[model samples]
Target: MNDYYGSVPLEEYEQILSNREYWDNISGEWEMCSKMEDKLVRLGTFVQRGGDLNRVIALYAGGREYTYRVTIQHCIERYLEALTNKRVDNLKLRLFKLEKEEAVKLLSEMLKVSIGVDFRYDKYTSRQVSFGVLDTRWLDAEGILTAIEQEHRQAHHDESVEEVRKRAHTWIGDSWW
Candidate 1:
């Protein structure tokens, strides 16, 4: 009988060394999670796996090791394209890249799209209730018409400003890494 303490089998040791070497030798910066498929059931935006959507969202969302917070997240494709090469791990560098007047335009557009529109997609714009028991004659024509019209809308709606938000999440997938 023997007590073999702190002993690793040769095969396992070699595998451990191999993994360490591979990870340590990786070039530049890397992350455990990069391209990932996220199900956007609410927006119905299907993100395919192993591309860059995860990275893009991370950058846009900001404050990770790879990059600082972008601060401003709204913009046209052209402005965002400018940031394609702007990679830095500091908040200043990220902000510097987007402090142009055009960036202001980007911010404006982003805010405007989601605002001004009703937050609730109530499916029913109008609700009128008229009930009579003794009179037993519910005379309501407009209410019926409004309900019919509002049938198309949805309640508790979640959406994105397609042009600004979609590109920010999906199109900018390859950058800021």
Candidate 2:
């Protein structure tokens, strides 16, 4: 029912090109967020390795903390754009977005809690929250991967055979394998 050029249909090539363009438009922001996430991982590793708490606090105070939040927020906005443009109507996607927002809120709350503990006074007692605690809460790789898998499954279920074939062709054409 569909025409093919070599291993892929012309229609699929056009679709792939459109997808590439969409990704390219957001690639810069995505790369920036990825780099920031890498730095966050490194920071978490540093704290786990028993790095100096005072120096760590000083580094975070120098803008890393703000940058981390801003980067994450930017990433969330970009993800929302992708989901919206793709017309994704999956409950998992909604749950994933909600989880991300909750993580951000928790991070803010943890920081606020830490401030009171870091500068303890007779009337300002608060529970101490470690950097590792915040890092683990925010960087949930498994949960993200699961959400993505669920979204892809939902997307896949809606695809016609021709659509799936075209997607496979596009993938093979784009990848070395």
Which candidate number maximizes lDDT? 2
Instruction: Give the per-residue lDDT digits (tens) of candidate 2, residues 1-177.
Output: 111112344334333322212122234543543343333333233323333323333332343334332333333333332323332234233333333324333322323222211122234435433222222333434355456556656655665666545433432222111
lDDT of 1 by residue, 1-177 (tens): 011111444334333322211121132321242111111110011111112232333323343332222222322232222222232222222333331332333322322222121122334645432211111023232243234324312431343345334333432332332
Clashing pairs in 1: none
Which ten contiguous residues of candidate 2 have the minimum total lDDT? 112-121
Alpha-carbon local distance difference test for all models:
0.26, 0.33
Instruction: State the local distance difference test value for candidate 1.
Output: 0.26
TM-score of each: 0.17, 0.20
